[model samples]
Target: MDVFIFQLSEFAQLVFETTWLPLVIWTVISFGVWFFLQMFENVHPIYQYHTRLALIFSLPAGLLSLASIHYISDWITASAGDGLTMITVISPIDISFTQVEESSGIPFMVIVQSLAVAIFFSGMIFFLIRFCMHAINLKKLRKSLNYRPISEMTSLSPENRGLALATGKNVQVAFLNSEIIPVTFGFRKPVILLPDTLKSQPEKLNLALRHELTHITQHDFFSHLMVILTEAVFWFHPLVHRLKRELVEYREMRCDNIVLSEASVSRKEYASLLLELIPMPNLNKELSVNMAQESSNLKKRITMITQQSKTKPIPKQTSLILLGVIFISTALAMACTDMQTQNVFDEEELDLMTNIDKTGEQGFHEIIIYMSEEEQAERHESKLEQLRMLEPEHIESVHVWKGD
Candidate 1:
């Protein structure tokens, strides 16, 4: 159990170290862009939405790149004769658990590190379980509601039917007898769940359909799923939650913008529709995009609908260039940070020792030593003698294990 916990701690430390720089870069880039957007006006909501989405997935990509670079650089250093070893040198010696404990019970840092990792994994599991529960609720909600295909609804006029078809062939729409607000969800088979009350009022129902269909057209459901997954993994980060909220706001605003651009309904009437739905209860919102989910964003959505400017849309090239700059800057920052951490190699050496320990047979005392492959090939015996001599005074017996 101790070994197991220690292994978990080591794994956690490695992951945290590998990801810390990228995570920091992500937060800085996300919040900096979000704050800038807050200060400005009329920066096309779709542009804002895409920007946040890119940042959402960038952190993981950056971490993978960083790991690849780190290992590749190490290999290049070894091949170029930069004094780094290519293979781990392992020489085992008899070192009893008693002697090891008496000399140093356990490093204080190791226990503390293990505790921290335990807490992190616990929180992650808790959030993951919550996400699963929400999914189950969504399943139940789908089954319990009395629903029928929107196509079968007699009240859908020709225009509304055309809009529904244009949304997508895979998109599913249903009018269900429920008190909850209209919501959009699903990935392969996207769904729009509308309240049955809208059946008697064709105009309001059409407006609701437009809003939910706009969500499907923009692929907000997939975005919502990705963001929720991110939130579950990074449940501890405040910036992650903030990112989620920002995406929600921007996507909804963008959806509203698209609906308004069609000019099928006046802004005043649309805003009034939003007002009527503002207080409706939301169900499984994290898994779905609930129209008018909260009061604060509801206020912003209404404000944008009523007061938006006819600003020229940002060119795609410009947006890509800006995103490229942010990504490049983040990479550079990570490189600089890595250069400053000289002890990272030592930590990796310790990891190799831990791995060697894992292979110890029961009832056998073992001491694992790490050396460069080059050193072992050249001055194997002399280096081995020197390392053995350098072994701690407390070690009474010595047995070395060498690999060919």
Candidate 2:
């Protein structure tokens, strides 16, 4: 148990040390993208949507890519006949919790790291539980749905004709008897639910269908799922929640754009439709895209719909800025990880690196342990002998042999 705790502590410390800086950098970059969009008077919603997603996903993707490359590069260098391998000499004080307690007690830093890991995991677990519960509730709701074919939906005007054809052939539609707002969800067989109230109003029903179908055709359900997962992982980051809000806002606007671009309704009519809609209680937000999800952003959505022309292609300046932010942030993160690999174990107090002879053969090393008169070397004789017999190919850190 002690060994397991020691190893866990070390792993936690390593992960924390390597990731904290990158996370900071990524957060700043994410905010930069967000703030940049806010600065513009009329950035396209699709552009905003894609950019935010890129920022959200870049951290994990960048970290995994860089960490893998760093590991592989180190492994290759260590395997070469003339490579200088890094050997992190672990001190007894670093790993021996019992011995440390017997002496000056467990290190404060170790305790803090353990607590941080515990807190992070606890929060993550809490969110994951919430996510699962919501999913189960959504599943129950799905089972209760009395679905009807899109063809069977109430009267469709000539302007809204063929809009249903644009959606996936297997898409299902239903009307909930409750007063809840419209929602679209599901993957293998996507489903859209409208309030029973809308059933009696054919014009509003057609407009609602256009909006929900935009979400269905764009696969926003999976995108919404990704946002939920990001929230779980980055639950502590305030900016994550902010980005989520921004995503929903832009996503709704983009759907509005698509619906308007189809020329089904005039800008004035769409704005009036948005104004008439009110926020209704949603059952499972994470599992479904509620049409009125952005009730708070309704004014902004209406303004965008009325003012903006047809959706614009991304501006070159916006694209360049996004690329620059991603490139620089990723480079800095990789540098930090590399530096941590090289210097993580080089402590001034332990003097672990002083024992290594760098002047020796390229792929070989000698680690000499100096003991005080109060300490007996004989206690570690077997361990020393074992270390002496090991070859470069057998060890992960590579090429360490004990010296007389």
Candidate 3:
């Protein structure tokens, strides 16, 4: 048991140290790949498809990296040990698979099954919490927005003029009691709405309408719903938050481009109009409509538009080279599992009974005691109880070893 505990602890330490570099490399690669894919195009069909693929591949890549670490550790230990009997001790339990027929105590199948069950329960708890939060948010959004019916017609108010043109329908616009939110709700027959004050200014109303209509044309509400779900599912990853922010910005940029292209408005003119209608007093109320927030990025948006040119085409060879590099990196990471050795010990020849007092004196006193399994178990239990009684601040760690 003592030998097993020592070996298992060493194995865990080895795995952690060996895998740290590879894990860091993979994390950076994954983030960079995803970021570049996002920046290559605004929220278009191709960009969305690539983003989904990146997300799907990243999960398995992360899991595989972790598994490779464990596999490497186990392989090294097994190789080094050769044919000697080995056991692994995890707290009170000791697992030995070296001589399965003779020992008949703890089977390898039992350990694997137990681990699977624990993982299953942990995953269930995580998903349950995520689903509940999403359901609550959906209910709140439905209750907060009042839906008004609409049919075919021409522009009604200045606020919904852009929406009418974009949807190709004279949609009815509602004045929600809630401030500057212009949301489209309901299925089959959708309704668009704006704040009552927005109807006064023609310029402000036009800009607001363009923003909202962008939402309708792009089905941005549905995109937002998908983002929210992804965030809930991956609440633990900081990258998930980063991805959401990037997607929101891209969505807005795509819509802005569409609106500007159709209106044939130069960057300066559109930017001037955007600044004038900047929702100063009602900025807080406009949070729902302006997903990116009214910040300095407004200037960046104008710069992007002013500098926009035809996207440079990538050569097929360059694309192939990039893909090849990614594949090679992944292969190298996976290959690390194949080059490990195992651990070994000779129990009979070592004469554990005689070597009981052979502890080398260093900084601390070392003691070795020889005892039967029953006696050793009792001693271990006693020591554990004593350690528990000690104040956590005063106690460090206790190490135990066995004599043959």
Question: For each candidate, what TM-score against the reference?
Answer: 0.73, 0.74, 0.45
RMSD over all Cα atoms, model 2: 9.3
Q: 11-79 in candidate 3: lDDT tens per residue?
A: 555654444455555556667777677586543432443353344334445546657766776797667
Instruction: Give the Cα RMSD of candidate 1.
Output: 7.4
Candidate 1 lDDT, tens digit per residue, 1-404? 77877887798788777677667767777788778877874687767776777676666556666777788888787677636654443444445455453545556777888888888889889988987888888777667655556677677767667777776656667766667788977766667788878878788888888888777766777768778887777788897787788888877887787777764567877888887777788877777788877878888888777776542443557766766666566555555556445345544544444443443442344445555454643534543444345435434456555553
Per-residue C-alpha lDDT of model 2 across residues 164-194, encoded as one tens digit per residue: 6766557778888888777888876888888
In terms of lDDT, model 2 sits at 0.69
Highest lDDT model number: 1
Residue 315 CA error for candidate 3 (Å)? 16
Output the better candidate (2/3) by TM-score. 2
Which has the greatest TM-score?
2
**Could you tell me the lDDT of residue 35 within candidate 3?**
69
Give per-candidate clash totals.
1, 0, 12
The parts of candidate 1 lying over 4 Å away from their true place are 67-104, 157-160, 309-404
